[model samples]
Target: MVEIAMRSYWNEGPTEVSLNGLCQRAGVSKPSVYREFGNEDGLTHAALENYGHCVLAKVLEILAGEDIFAGKIRKIAYLAAEDGAHESGCLFVKMRTAKNQMGEKTQILIAAMASMAVDAYANLLIEGRETGEWPGNIPVKLGAAYLHAQIGLALDQRARGEDPRVVLALALCVLGLTDAQSEIA
Candidate 1:
């Protein structure tokens, strides 16, 4: 039932997915869903958590991977632009876009997750600087925020049905990657 709800929220926006619909589709009773998840907010929170683990974790993995900073950044672009799992768009990005309509609990979770992503990116930039993969002139915090924003923008474009190749090219370009280096797609 949780998996069904997560996928529904991923493929369709959370606002578009109703608890009643989820119950019916998951072959569970409304009371069961409520009992298990507490409420719509609880259910949404659960689904987002699951998405972080299942989908967003890949980005965290890339950040933590052995690849150079540029390679890691390129991989993130490819994930946003060409990953099969994100063909329908990113669930987190969708939720983030509609965070204004989210329940308080979900909103809080979103904020925390966004901050954590920035911190992770900052750490990656610090490592990159140490390894001389990128220049040390850029402030790590600012660079991290920039990278995070770029990724979100790329994912937003992908969600809007932009051509994957175009999205990849533009994302790489913004990350200072040349055309030759943007050939990962």
Candidate 2:
């Protein structure tokens, strides 16, 4: 049931999916879902947590890797471009986009996830500077914020059906990722 709800909420916008629809798709009763999740907010929050563990964990792992900063950025851009089987968009991105309509639990989770992502990005930038893998012209804090926004923008573009290669090229260019477009292409 949680998997069904996560997939539905990931492919379809969170605001667009209904609890009853989830229950039907998951072959479960409404009361069962409510009993398990408490309410729609609880269900959504749980789904988000699941997504964080299943999908976002890999991204965080990449950020925490020994790879150079540019490599990490390119990998993330490719991930966003591919977006695996869920072609609609990122669940996190979708949830963040519809944050205003979400319940308090979901909203809080979204904000926390956003902050975590930014912090991860910041840490990566700091490491990049320390290792001399990326130039430090931009302040680490500012660069982290910019990279986070750029990644979100890339995911948003993918959701809008933009060409994946074009998205990849643009992201690499914007990040100044040293001839990565040609190599990645």
Candidate 3:
């Protein structure tokens, strides 16, 4: 039920959400929803938490893996190429893009999620630099920001109904990775 509401937020954005809609979609009673999550804010908060752990666990693993940015980017691009994965949407992108419309707690959670992702991305950039896989001329922070921005753009395009393959290819080009180098696909 929480996840259903979360997906509603991701797929439909803030304008289309309602407790009634969530209950109907989730097949749970209104009272049950309130009992479980306290209120809409609580429900959305729980939803984001559920999404971050359950739906995003595998993605988080890949982010924390030994692979460099190119490999990671290519792998995500391939996932985007897949039909189901492309349609599921990205939580960070959705939440970050919609933070201003969310409640205070939900907004805070989005900040935490975004900050954690940036930290992880920066760490990966540092590791890639150490291995000569990431760009040496750019500072690690800048490289991390660039990579993060590229991914955010790719996901945004994916959300906007662009061909996931093309969106990813554009991002890879921005990151300076050739198809030959991105064998993770």
Task: Pull out the clashing pairs in model 1.
Answer: none
Stretches of candidate 3 exceeding 4 Å from the true structure:
29-31, 81-83, 178-185
Tell me the whole-model lDDT of each prediction, alpha carbons only.
Answer: 0.80, 0.81, 0.69
* Candidate 3 lDDT over residue span 1-185, tens digit each: 87688778778875467889888899999999879877777888888888888756666678788776667755655654553754746766777777787788888988887777677767876776677675556666765676666667666777777655555555455555555234433
| TM-scores, all models, native as reference | 0.89, 0.89, 0.82
- Ranking the candidates on lDDT from highest down gives 2, 1, 3
Report the alpha-carbon TM-score of model 3 versus the true structure.
Answer: 0.82
- Give the C-alpha lDDT of model 2: 0.81
Clashes of each: 0, 0, 0
Clashing pairs in 2: none
TM-score of 2: 0.89
lDDT of 1 at 51: 90
> Which of 2 and 3 is the better model by lDDT?
2
